[model samples]
Structures are given as structure tokens and as C-alpha cells.
Target: MRSPRRQPVAGAATRTGPPVPPAWMRWLPVCYVAVVLILEPLTPVDWPVSFLLVALPLVTAFAHGPLVVAGATALAVVLEGVLAGTPCCAGRSVGYLWDRHYVADYVCTVLVGGLGTILAAHRIHRERTLADVRFVADIAQRVLLRPLPRRIGNLRLESFYLSATAEARIGGDLYEAVPTAFGVRLLIGDVRGKGLLAVETAAAVLGAFREAAHEEPDLAALARRMEQSVSRRAAHIGGSETGERFVTAVFAEIPADGRVVRVVNCGHPPPLLVRPDEVRELDSGRSGPPLNLGMLLTEAHHIDSYPFRPGEQLLLYTDGVTETRDANGVFYPLARRLRSWGPLEPRTLLDRLHHDLLDYSGDRLQDDTAALAACLLDGGPRSVDDSSEP
Candidate 1:
């Protein structure tokens, strides 16, 4: 089935069409060599300068692509013959335009440039192959772990995820959402480490939650499954000390009724609950340990719930959002910063947050960060395609 179209998230932008071959392709350095080799002996009218004509096609090929390269070479040959002279062919011997030197120079230009065009085409193919690989990897990542829904049921969802390094894609930060029997369950968390491994832990938590959310009636059981999944996976890698390897997270469910919400905070930042009347931070009340913290064996066993009303929204995220620091080494004022934008679509909220972060750091982010916001409403999602990426 075909997927619905989506709008580009605020900050993400991509260039269209093929990559440039190379600027020098418009004229080969070898064309420069041809001029020196042929110019000195030309019958002033012969103008070995015809050879220089080859450079335009060759350079254009490099600056553009194979088709451009071929046409450029052909145009160069015609221009060289007209401006300079043509070969002294027997058929046109009576004309000065048919001089032997002019013919030889024009012929040589085509031969040299034709070879350059062939080679430039190969280079273009190689570049396209590399680009294809990168594109496939990007598409696969988006599929395996689809982005958090822009709108889950009646709530408007918006998010931002940035890796620790500019080159990175996935990171230790993770979030997930799915419509379940109870409601639209959403989660946001941060692993202890960074990079691919953190993503693995995140996947494990999400996988468990997906299955448990629908099966378990009690919220604590759902939280336990997440804890168990992370713990079990960590043991397979790290062993006994894994308890200290925790994931700070906030989990919540937006019910079908659209009038209420419940949450379980596990050593994560308390989500800020925003309503038309007022904006307030929601505490964990009685908290559970973060998912991977194996404290479950001997520690407590329950998760907390909350009151989520319509026209209200919830913002859940890792410490990266609040912990961002600025020029004087001062931390970013998240609450005050968010106050700058009163209420907005989730995608816009995330876009502005990402922009604020980049601006705060002067065009670069220092640490990995992730944020997810959802607005409660009395209606179903506006439209599926509009809610996600295009």
C-alpha cells in the first residue's frame, strides 16, 4: 500500500537531485597541457587553440554529469573548427577552412575529450552509488523505528531528537507511542550510555511496552515488563552490575475518553503539564526506579498515575533538554525558554526547541537530546499523514 504524504519536520531539510561531478570537469587540466603542446607550431591560422576547445566539454562534464559532458565535448568540437580551422580533407581542399592543421587539432580535441567524458561518467556513477547506500540506510532506520506519531488519538505530538555528534543518526535517547486497548501510550527515556548500544536498550524497552501495554491491566505491570526487558537484555551483555545501568524515563497513557491521562515516572525528569489556564509540572508522586536499574529484585513494585485533561498537554524528555548549557557555562532555562512559545503544534514545538538549542550553543549541539510533547484534545487525530513526516 502507498503511504500518505507528510510535511517536513521544521528543522530537517535535504537537497534535491544528483550530486555535482566536480567543478574542474568543465575543463580538464590536460586541456591546458594540449594548448602548450600544440600552440607553438600552429600556422597562426591553424590556431592549435582548437585543442583548448576540448576543455569546455571536459570541465562541463565534471561540473555536471555524463550527458552534459558528451554535449559539451561535441559543442567544443564545432566551436573549435569554426573559430580556428578544420582538417585539410580532400573533399574540401579548396577552402582555407579545410587546412590540414585545423583538421588535426579539432580531431585530437574530440578524441581526448571523449575519453575524459567516459571517465567522468564512471566517477558520476560511483558518487550516485554511495548516495544510494546512504539513502537506503536512512530509509531503513526510519522504518525499523518509525518516528513518534505527530498525533496520537486526540493529542497533538511533537518531538526533537539530536545525537551527541553531528554525524550520528540514532542515539541513547529513545521514545515510542502506540494506540492500545487502554489508550495511546507514550514513552520517552535516556539510556546511561550513547550510540548504538543505547538504541538497543531503548528498543528492548519499547518492544516490551508494545506487548505489555495491551495485555496488562495494571500500569505497574507494564512498567515492570519494560524494566524486565531492559534488565534481561543488559544481563546478557553486562551481568550483575547492570542494576546501576539505568534508563531515566516518563511513561503516560492518553485514554480514549480524551479527558484523562496517567503516567509512571522512573527516575526521569517530571513532564511539564500545560493547559489553557495554566502550565504546571507533573511530579512522579511515588516513583519507580528507571527501567534498566535492576532494583526491582528487592526494591519497590508500583508505578504512578496522573490526571490528564483536555486542552492540556504533556512534555516528556531526557535531561539533555533541561541540562543544555550556554556561553557563560550557564544551563539553558527550559521552563522560561518554553514559555516563549505558549502553545503550538507538536512538530512546531519540537522545531522551535531544536532551534533554541542550536542558537543557545551557537549553531551546534554539545550533547545528545530528545523531547516529545503531546496536546490533549476531545477529538481524534486531525489526519494520519499530516501527523507524521513527508
Candidate 2:
């Protein structure tokens, strides 16, 4: 079933340009000038305290734009003249304003100010370019990994995705759920490598799953189709990396009856079954080769079925979730976290998991992560006809 597209979490971290400086930072040039003015009258004239104003434009450039830096430069030159001409306790004369030493100070201030203005302009241009690049990346990510529907048939779904790169919106991890005539078919996988190539591989896998989920009745056959798709994509890419490009994925089918869930594991992390009493891993005794490497396996892929009655939640995630490490290098305890929590709605379960994972890893991830949480609601479809209800 199709649902409205929504961000994974309400307050999830977003990729943005460099942070804006604090308000206090913006006033630093003014503060510096005030300090200079206060010290000029009290200090000895030999100190040439007015010459220190040359730094005004440079300081302003850090927090302000080109125009502000130029203004600060002009202000510094005028203030230097004022201080040179005004009689202080040292009894300086107005003739000192045109003194070669004072003139040199003014020239130096203007030179530094010109450089500061150019620096500010370059910084602003780079920020705008970075912003444009991030925008395009975000759009591509949304298109490749469209948000999963909150409700598909009798299942309540919630999903989360995080890229390891702070400025990247998507990476190697991917997940997709489609409600088909047979049931709700879910796919979650991680590409073998990082960067744009991995993203492209993920896109190929997801495109294949979305198209084949409705057509393939058997989980094994669906997996085979994915393998073929990945193989063709690799062939098209055609490089030394082609041999390294493979995906570990899990395919799940939640039947209309909502009595059981069938899962096919392909060299991927097993899904966790979270029940009110206990949590279980739906591990297929025999593991299948990952996509693009299916030819290495002579035996058929293993499909395991486990009871998935109402109130039970199934959590599907890439290895990135479990492999996340703490400051001490300990892997995240995914099952323990699930077992400790009381029954939670699908969205709440995933939201908590997302925050917990980030907190456990010190708010940094070594790999791209993706997760899908599905809770079977009460009075779910009991048959094919019952599944037709909206």
C-alpha cells in the first residue's frame, strides 16, 4: 500500500553547511575597537596602540561578509587617524596624523582589509556551492530510498536511515517494503563498499526488489531475481571493483493471515522477533550466498518461517546497526535492547532504537545504517479477501 512520504524521525540530524558563528562572535570587531579606544587614552603614545587596529578587518572577516569587513577596515583607518591627531596625556600633536609612521599604519590596515574582503567572498561562495551539492544529494537519496508506508495491510511500519558521512544524505545501506497481492515483501541490504559506487549498487538492488517483489511468489525466486539484477548491474559497471560489489540482504514475506513471517537470509544479519515475553533471532540454519555471488552456492536458499502473531514486532536492519561500536569498541547489543523495552508502537520502537544507536556510538557511525520496524496489529487480515480492506 502507498503512504505519504515522511522523514524517518521528527528531530533527526540533517546535513547542513558549516554552523553560523555565535552572535557574540559577530560583535568581536566592535568589542576590539572599543578596547582599543579605551586603551589609547591611558597608554603611552610610544606603544602606537592605534596601529593595532589593523587587525579589525581580519577579525571581522571571520564572522561577517565582505561588506562588513570593508566597513571595519574603513573604520579602523579613521579611528587610527583620530587617535593620532587627538592630544592624549602624552601630549601628541595633530601633525602626527600625517606622520610617515601613521600613514604606513593606515596603508597596512587597508591592505589587510582588502585581503579580508576577498577571503569573506570566497568563503561565502564555497558555502553556497556546498549547499547546492548537498541539496542534489538529498534529492537523489529520497528518490532511491523512498520512505516506507506507515501502514501496509495489517502491519505498522517505521524506518530509519543514517549515512556515516556527516554531510552525506545516503550511503550503502538500503531498505524497501511493498505490499503485494501475496503479502508484504520487505528488503533490507548493505552494499559491500562505500561512496557513490555503493550508493549506485544499492539503487540497483532496490529497483530490482520493488519490481520483482510483486511478481515472484517464492522468497527464493525473489532473491534469485535480485541476484540477477545485481549481476547485470555489475557487468554494466565493468571494473576491478565489479568483483567486490556484492550485497548482503534479507527478504521477508508477511502473509495476509498475519499468523507467520517467512524470511530468506543471504549472508546478512538475521532479523529479530520482538515479542512481549522475549526476543528471538529468525536465523535460517543454513546461510545463502549474498547477491551477485549466488552462483557459488549449489544448494537452494534457506527460508525460515516463524510465528508473527499480533503485538509481535519484527526488526530488520543492515549489519551496520549491530556492528556499531561504542567508545570502547564494543558492538551494540541489539537483542538486549529489544528485550529490555516494553511493548512499543512501531514508530516509537524505531525512534528509540535510532537514538540509542547514535548515543551508543557517541553520535558517530562507521558505516551507513538502515532499519525497518514492523508491528503486527490486532485483527489483521485473516485471508486474501480480508487483506483487501483499506
Candidate 3:
């Protein structure tokens, strides 16, 4: 029979608590079961004293629902108390060790050890369910954060991502792409911090962009919507200044049939212009601050337009990319390094850059790194109006 899926424990997680486990953390349960079996022989005393295996089932029990926990607890009770031999009761005569009370021992085991196991396993089951929910959240993000296309404008996109943490979860760093009336609008931004709060902000920004791209004809309006979304979120949190959350971002909209692109630099790193033969930063031509910083700095975001020629691609990213430190503690120079590697497809570029970035950091990051590359297609060749031709 199929094992019923478990559910997360309600009313357990506080806004501040232990971080959830990653999706790849399945082996932890198997490890838990193994530990239980190893120490089940002397539970509550030797088991708890030796290895705290009792806590394992308790935590596990908390994770699964009542039915599942009941099954596991019953099985463990039978195995440990009945089959494995319970301790002799009350020094009842040396001969009584294997006496007729065996049936009573079985019942006692079911009543006592079963209850204990049920409690422990329930906790564990709750934890596992919570972890599973968080994993699904991370996976669902990939849908809105689609992989960048192979080509844009005339440039070949090559991008890479590496989180500073061991668990490969996306947080703080964010990116997006959507077709608009003008052309394709893209964004790459970073929340002020890491973990769930940052992920939530990232989600809000992308969700707004996905809807705004199709509705807003002007890039300026699109930027405003995103800015409002962040502000609204901060307000919803209803915390003091120290409790406030914010993000820095860069928004860009490329024209369908031209070299002109509009960008709003909301306190983010400037994008780099990379070509087969040249590399330079796209002077954002603004003094505007980041999105959430607007409330603090009191500056209106300015829309800056720049030239995006064919054969040249723009690279946008979170600070994690350029700020990565080496053994000597020197930061990575993405502009110089990216130009050194010849043009590659979006996937290849992301993979290559991700690999090289990890190599620089020994495949581990202390923060999340997000990079996006958008290249203009057709270079300088006369391009047909493919939008309407089809």
C-alpha cells in the first residue's frame, strides 16, 4: 500500500525559528530511522543517555500526521519492547524473566513505548513536512525565474549563479524576463538580506514584473509598479525601522527593432557591456538610489536610456557575483573575467560562469550569486520585422 503523504504541523513556526531543510536533505530521515533502530534496544534511559535517539522519533512524529505516526510508533514498540525483550519487571524472580507476563509485556510496550515513539515521531514528521513545503517553494520559483534565452539583441547570453551557502537555494538575488510591446523587458535585483524574507521580496518583485510587462506600455510605468510593490510589502510587514526590509534593483526594457534601451538603476550594480573585442560598463547616467533606499535617501528614481548595439551583450547581476572573495580575500572582477571568455549561449554562459565563479570560491559561496546576460541578436545585419512576419 502507498504510504500516505505527511502534512506540515500548523502553528509551529514562528517568524523567527530554525531554518527549513533543503530539498536534497532527504537522507536525514533515513539517518533518523537508522539511529532509532541502533538505540531502540535501551530507549528512555540508555537510548536517550547514549545518543538521544528518543528525540529523533519525537521530532519525526511531530512531522507526520497522527495516522502515520501511530503506525511507526506501533511498529517500533513491537520491535523494541516485545521482540527485542523488555527489562524484567520489579525483580519478580530470576525465573520470571521469561514468564507468562510476556503478553502483559507486549501490551505494556504498546501502551508506553508506543506513546513515546508516537510523540517523538510526530515532531520529526512535522519538521520534515515543513522542510518539504519550503523545498516546493524553491522549486516553484524556477517557473517565474525562467532560464534566460540563448540569444537577445545581437549578443549571446552567458550567465551563471552560485549561492554563498552550501544549500543551493535562491534568495535575495532575483532576475526576470518578459516580452513587451517595445521589446523584451528584463530585470536583475537583490534584496538587502538573505533567507526567507529575501526570497519573499524577490517573489513580489518578479510577480509584479510578469504582470506589468504585458500591461504597461512604458518602461517608466513598469518601474513605478515594481517600486510600489516593494514599498507596499514593507508597509505590510509593519515593523519598526530596524524591522524594515528593502531591496536594490536594476530594471531595463529593450526596444524591439532598435539599439536603444531604457534602464532604471534602483541602487544596483551597473551592467557591463561585453563584446568579442571590448568590455565596458553601461554608464547608468543617474544619481538615483535603490528601490527601498528611496524612502531613506529621499531621491526619485530616474529612468536612464542607453545604447545596446548588436554583437554586444549586457551582464546584470547581484553583488554576490562581483563581491565573491578569493583565498587572499580579493574580490572577483566580473567585467574583466567575463570579457576574457569568448561569447557563449545563455545556458553555456551561465554554466561556464557558474563553474568559474565556484572555482574562484572553491564551489562555495557565503552569499547568493545571480548573473544574467542578454545579447542583441542579428548584430549589424539588416533584420526583418520578425514580430509581424510570422
Candidate 4:
């Protein structure tokens, strides 16, 4: 059996943490130096041997810091001097100290080297500033959507989130897990829009869920509480935009000692039930309208229950996963693709989906994607109130 506390989720794309090549790779410029040296003797007098010297610093800048570039510049200047004294087309060495050709060549080499060094330093400063900004964004993301624990009681948990906007660490997609008095309550959702407004709505929804999940006894009641919270918050929004905001969500509860999972869908995509023998979608007949739009529907939200036996897995995801399209506009067939895997642990399942989604989209997605996978362990669920007793 897999370890309960170990997380196997693939990490999100990180912009601020660009990979640095190995130390040995930095010496690649040494090969270019060799090429330039050999080419100098073979070229004709009009070929401009000093032109190659200026390239040394430029090439070095990519892998080395300003200090290293300065060292390279010095070596380049030395090589230029050597070239001036070497034999040219007429078998006579090119003039040295006083010749205008050598003087101009040396000056150009110095100028190019200095400019390259400055550029390298500026690049380093810009990267450092970006890193600081990303650190702040990471903190904000954690506060807004708290990270899910790898293990909660007897269930193994794994989650993945990818924002459509490049360089944006967080987006409107959200998920949260709360060990409440009733059971381990979970919420996965997607806001109707994107950008700052959507993020604010998402934050409001999560805050409401965290507070109410502990008080509600059933998944339907919990979903209604969340709907009320969103409605109340949206009511405060000014102008015609107030009624336009809404959220698609799926709320679930895994009881403390039962092998069953209760779900209340709110105009959201259905969750998948993957077992060793088969894969199926948990299509709840009692599903209702999305949050903030419940006034249109007269019936109370339906609560659907399904067996969640040991070694089985449940996957909750936003529409981003199902609606992703390729160049030909073909939607990602998640259920069809999932059937091929038979059964897998929560983390491994998410990891495979993450890569597969990227491959399908050619590494670019039209919307943000978020997924949560939970695997039932071979034991009775621990009481949420008294975990120490378990």
C-alpha cells in the first residue's frame, strides 16, 4: 500500500524559479573560443578578425555573471593584440602599437565587452525582482486557497491547478477541504469569469464554505448554505453586473465510518468514480442550478449517494478539464482516456492527467484547470472531531 502522508501531485508551472544549468555547462563558451582562434589564421586579411573577439563576451553573458563576462572581455582584448602581430596576406605581420587599425579594433572590443557586461547585470536584477513578486503571489495564493493535505483521516488526497494566464500563479478556480463535525467536507468550483473580480468571488465562496461546512449536517444543506453565502455577497456588487456573477461547484462529504460518498452538484461537471474494475461518472439525479442563480429553480437541491469502497478513487474537476480543445477543436475526452488506466492512486492519477492535458493543448490552455482526487484507504474513517482516538 502507498504511504498515506506522501503527496504525489505534480507541481504547478513556476515562472520565478527558472532552472539554472549545471556548473559544467557554463564552460561551453570555451569551445567557441577555440573555434574563433582557429578561424583567425585561416581567414583572409579583409575578413575582420577583431569581429569574432567581440562575440566572446556576448556569448558568455548567457551563462555567466557580469564578473565572468569582464574576465572574458579581458581575454578577448589579449587575443586581439595577438592577432595584430600575426602574419597577414602579404606574409608581413600587421602593425602593432601605433597602427590605426589595431587602435580602433581594441577600442571596439572594449566597448562591446563593457556593454555586454552591463546587460548581464541588468538581466540578473530583473530576475531577482520577479522572484520577489512571485514569492508574494505564492503567499496570497496559499491564503486564498489553502493547500490540501496529502492525507486526511483514512483517505489519500492529491490536487492540481493550472492557470490559463501565463505568469499568473493563481486564478478563479478553487478547491478546499474541511474536516467538519459531520465528515471530511470538500468543495471544488470555478467562477463564471476570470481576472481579479473572479478571484474575489472565489475567495468569498471559499470563506463561506470553510465557515459553514462545520455547521451543516448534510451535503445538500451545506451546498444551500454556500449558495446563500454567494448570493448575499453578490448582492453587494454594484450595477447590472451584480446578477451576472455565479459559480459552478460540486460539494461532497465522506462520512466518518461509512463507505459511501454524498454529493450535491451545483450546475457543475460530474465527478468521476474510478475503481479497479471500471470507471464511471457519478451523475447525480438531484443536481441543481449553479450557486447565486438558485432562484430560477423551485426544487431543493438533490443529494446523491454512491459507494466509495477501499482502493477506489473519486476525481473532482472543473470544466477546464473537460472543455479543453486541440487545434481541430476536439474536446478532451477525459472519461474515455481514464478508462484505459483501470485503477491508480490519487497522486499518480493526477500526475498523468496533468501531463496529458498539457500535451493535448500543446502546452496552452484557454481556461484555468483545477482537480482533486481522493483514494479510500483500507480502514474505517477517523472521527473529524477526535482524530486522536482513531
Best candidate, TM-score-wise?
Answer: 2
Number of clashes recorded per candidate: 11, 0, 37, 0
Candidate ordering by TM-score (highest first): 2, 4, 1, 3
Give TM per candidate.
Answer: 0.67, 0.90, 0.61, 0.87
Instruction: Give the per-residue lDDT of model 2 (tens digit) for 292-334.
Output: 9977889878788898989999999998889999999999999
Give the C-alpha lDDT of model 3.
0.62
> What TM-score number comes out for model 1?
0.67
**For model 3, how does the per-residue alpha-carbon lDDT over 155-230 read when each residue is reduced to its tens digit?**
3444444556543445678887666666777888888876677778788888887888889777667777777778
Per-residue lDDT of 1-390 in model 1, one digit per residue for the tens? 322222222233333345653546445645654563465344453334445665565555556666766776677667665554333422333434456776776777778678778877788887778667656545544643466666655667776676655445566777777777677778888888766677777777767777887887766677777877787888887865666667887778776764667888887888887666566777746677787764554655545556776666788878887777777788888777677678766667777778777768664456678888887766554422234432
Off by over 4 Å in 4: 1-25, 88-90, 237-239, 385-390
lDDT of residue 12 for candidate 2: 24
By lDDT, highest first, what's the ranking?
2, 4, 1, 3
In model 1, the worst 10-residue window by lDDT is 1-10
lDDT for model 2, on a 0 to 1 scale?
0.83
Candidate 3 residue spans exceeding 4 A from truth? 1-138, 148-160, 242-244, 296-300, 379-390
Error of 4 at 110 (Å): 2.0
Q: What is the C-alpha lDDT of each candidate?
A: 0.67, 0.83, 0.62, 0.81
In angstroms, the error of model 4 at 335 is: 1.2
What overall lDDT, based on C-alpha atoms, would model 4 receive against the true structure? 0.81
Best by lDDT: 2
Off by over 4 Å in 1: 1-62, 70-119, 147-153, 160-169, 238-246, 257-260, 284-288, 296-298, 327-329, 379-390
